[model samples]
Structure formats: C-alpha cells, structure tokens
Target chain A: MEISYRDMITVLHGMGFGVLFMLAFSGAIGVIYATTVVGPQWPRSQWDNAMFRFYLISMAALAWLATISGAYIIYPWYRAVPPAGTTDLSAYPRALLLSSPRTAGWHDIGMEWKEHIAWFTPIAMTMVAYVFIKYGPRLALHRQMRNAVLGFTAVAFFSTAVAGLFGAFLNKYAPVRGGPDIVLMQEK
Target chain B: MSAEHQPIGLPTGPGAAAILAAGIGSLALGVFSFAGDAVPAINRAFIFWQPSGALSGVTITAIVIWLVSWFGLSRRWAGRDVALGTVNVAAFVMLVVALLLTFPPFMDLLQEI
Candidate 1:
C-alpha cells in the first residue's frame, strides 16, 4: 500500500496532534476542577501538585504542536494558489474548495474561521498551564485567580473543539493531497 | 514547575498578567485577521512569508504581542497582588470579543456597517 506524503502529514496534523490535544481537554479540565474545587478540602503533596502541573504543561505542549504544525507546515500547502489557467485544481485545496459554489462556503467560512480560532487554544492553554504551575494546590486560596484559570482552560477547550470540528469537515470535502508517495507494506 | 522545583503560592499578579496577556493576544489575532480579510492592502502586507500568505505574519505578530505583553505585565506586577477583579473581567470581556471578532458571520456583519 502507498500513501501520499501530504495526506500522511495532514492526518498527523489533524488526528495526530489536533485530536490528541482535543482529547486532552477532558483530563485537563477534570484535574483543573479538582485542583481548584476539591483540593482545598484535601491537601496534596508537592509530588502530587507537581504531577498536575506536568499534565497541564503536556497539554499546552500538545496545543502548541498542533497549532504550529497546522499553521506552518500544513496551511501553506492548503492555501497554495493554482497556476493561471489551471483546469485541474486537485493540488490546490483552497482553490479546489472555492472553484465550486457548492463548496465555496467551506473555504470562505469554515477555513477562515478555523485558521484563526484555532490559535486561541494554544495561547489560552499556555496561560492556564502557567497559572496552574505558578499556584499549584494553593490555587484554591485565590478564588479569583482560580476562576480565571478555569475560564481560560474552558475557552481553550471551546476553541479547539470548534477548530477540530471544522477541520474534519474541511478535510472531508477537500483533502490536502500531494507530495511524494510513501510505501507501506509491499509484496516481498 | 519540574519535579525538582517547588511550586509555591505565587501572588495573583503573575497569574493575572498571564491571563490578561492571553486575552490581548487573542484579540490581536482577531483584529489582524479581520483587517486582513477586509482590506486587500492589509492582506498583502500581512504576507510576511509567501508560502503561508498572510497567516504567517498574522500569527507571528500576535505571538509577539502576547509575549511582550506577558513580559511587561509580569514585570510590572510580579510578587505583588494586583487588582484581580478588574483584570479578570477585562480579560473575559476581551476573550468574548475576540471570539465574536473571529467568527466569519460576525466579521461580515460588522463590515456591513
């Protein structure tokens, strides 16, 4: 079996990094809630607190990886303009989506929104991680700080959800396909 | 913090700075994106890298803004507990506004005016 390089990278960008980051939100949110809401009732040791901080840091790292890969590596290919008078627009995903009125909205709305909104996830997540790391279990003491951290994490979750959903739909309609073919298992 | 490093109960100032800077960075992204969409000249100008188009510049600029604001605010309020109520509300408001601004429909709606 053979797969195009672009398809593999695109999958890595979306399913690999993006989806992993999205999945992490549930765990991160649960731990954040526990840190702020229930941790005050039961004190955690430095080890436990450090573990929670590490989790947040890992989530933030995933978010950064997802965003950077999408924007720098995948996005350039996705938005590559078709040469003049190009009849077959298969190589250009953006033009392909825009060539037909039926699919034009995918580029105009879905992609436009996805590219921009996706960024908030990393920024918000970084802040959440930093705040949690800074305060750790003591977050419960400062209620305002605790709430803001929770709120930002929630925003990161919401941002990634929107971006990931749109990304799935966009790929379904106009997949980013190109680059050298990579061979998997072959007859030997 | 790493396992070797201890996480103390830092003052709210540091946390607030991070939160506010995130909000500002998000808002900057929304603004730059909308501006690039609405103005052809601005769009062309934002093409810092040819391959990535305006997106390269937009994101980089926003990140620079985020880091700078974070550094400035952190230095300004480190150790001291700043007024968090105002910072919290302002940050949330900025986040909400950034969300609205990034929405395509909202951008179109505002552009129509």
Candidate 2:
C-alpha cells in the first residue's frame, strides 16, 4: 500500500523515538557498568562478561539506526524553503526548518552542535565493539577498552539529549498533521 | 584480599585516570576545533567537505590520537605507571591548552589584542 509523506514522517518519527529510547536505556546500563564494574576490584563473573557484550552490541546497533533516521528528519531543514506557487506549505512542519524565523533561537546553536556530535556516535560505538571482540578474555585489557566504551556512550547520550530537546521544540511550535493527509503525502 | 580475590581488571589508579583524561581531552579538543569561533582556518581549509564535515574530520582525528595513545601507552607500561607517566601528563596538558585556547573569553581576548 502507498504511504503519504505525513505517514512516512510519522513512521520515521516513531522509529526515531524507539531508537532514542533504546539508546537511553542502554546508555544508563553502560554508565553503571563503567562506574561500578570496569575496574580491578569489581566482581568478574561470566554473567558480567555476557552483559557487557550484550550492552555494547545493542548500543552500537541502536545508535547507528538512530543516526540514519535522525538524518532523514533533520537534513531537510538545512535547505527548507516555503512551498512554491499554489503548492500547499501547510502540510509541512515549519518548525523543522532552520530557515523558519518562528523556530530560530539559541537552540539552533545547540542543534548544530548536536548534529556534529551525533556523527561520532556510530563510529565510536563500532570501535568499542571492535576493541572488545578483538581483545576479549584479557581482563586487564578489557578494562581499558571499557574506559573507551564509556567515553563513546557518554557522547551518544549527550547527542540524544540534544536531539530530544530539538524535537520537543518542534512539537511545541509546529505540530505535523495526523491521519489521511499523512498517508496521501507519503504515497506522492 | 588474596590474589584470587583481587580483581583482574584495570586498577583504580593512574592508569584508569589516564584513560579517562585522554578520552575527555580528545572530546574537548573536538568541540573546540569545530564549535569554537577561534578556528576559522579549519572551516575554510577543507574544500572537499562541508564545514560540518570538516568539523567531523577534526573530531575524528582527535579521537584517533586518543585511541592510539591509550592503546600504545597502556600496552608498553603497566596500567598505574602509564597513568602516572609522561604520556598521561602530556595528554592532560594538551587538553588544558585546547580548553584555554577555545574558551570564548580567551578567543575574544586574542581577537582584541
């Protein structure tokens, strides 16, 4: 079945939200692991190793998905212009556009920073996964790798927070249309 | 605690501190090179990529440095000594200098004088 632009937006939005939620949950677990379990004095069980691997892999996958979905939602704003001629601009959310004076504020600076930092997430997380897989079973070496993983997760968390802030601002000012038009837009 | 009771991971000494410092330092340097107003050359120099791409390039470069230092130094020396040694000290100093140079007040002062 054909989907409308608005429907596509909604789908992308839902996917983005899901990814962000997963990132936050995994990131919290990562933070706990970094603080409590990464060092020499922490208990080392097979379960600990398993959990660490699970968390790192999940985080990396979720982050990469988030990056792609976020790009779809945000990149259009970089070149957003009002619909031309008789074409209806009402279907588009004005707040998504950086060009919109209504939505422009200091938050734009934060958004700009967020965009750049977001690029780092997938790369860093992938590296963490590589280091872990390549140097597993070496407890001392794993601890060092854990430190790097923690750093990468921290960056991911910060970027997600900034994206959420921007999302909230857009929702407040320029809520998108719901239902059939969304379906129709996506089909076109 | 006995040998078995002692954890087999990284120590909570200089080694861990060094790793943390290097990571944070690299992040700060990335931010400074991209977001700070002081580095206009970075923006103009990259012809192939957009300004944002250039910023990412700089940030990635810093991350590479941090990763290399963390792995190379840690492998060469014991964790605690690596943390306390000249390499960690150098990383920390580099972070400090990057912060100072990119700080808005510092950039403003430089522009004025």
Off by over 4 Å in 2: A1-48, A68-73, A80-102, A119-156, A171-188, B1-25, B28-41, B50-81, B84-113
Each model's DockQ score: 0.50, 0.14
Model 2, B9-54: lDDT tens per residue?
5443334434444545455554555443545775555323342344
TM-scores for candidates 1 onward, in order = 0.94, 0.54
Q: How well is each residue in A1-188 modelled by candidate 1, as lDDT tens digits? A: 98899999988988998888878888877877886668654236777777777888888888999899898998999998888999998889899999999999998889999999999999998999888777777777777777888898888888898889989998898899988999987977
Model 1 regions lying over 4 Å from their true place: A41-43, B1-9
RMSD of each: 4.3, 7.2
- Per-residue lDDT over A66-176 for candidate 2, one digit per residue giving the tens place of the 0 to 100 score: 665555444343324565662554444543444466565523554454444554555555555554543344533434445444555565565566555665555455544
Per prediction, fnat is 0.79, 0.03
Q: How much does candidate 1 score in TM-score?
A: 0.94
Judging by lDDT against the true structure, name the best candidate. 1
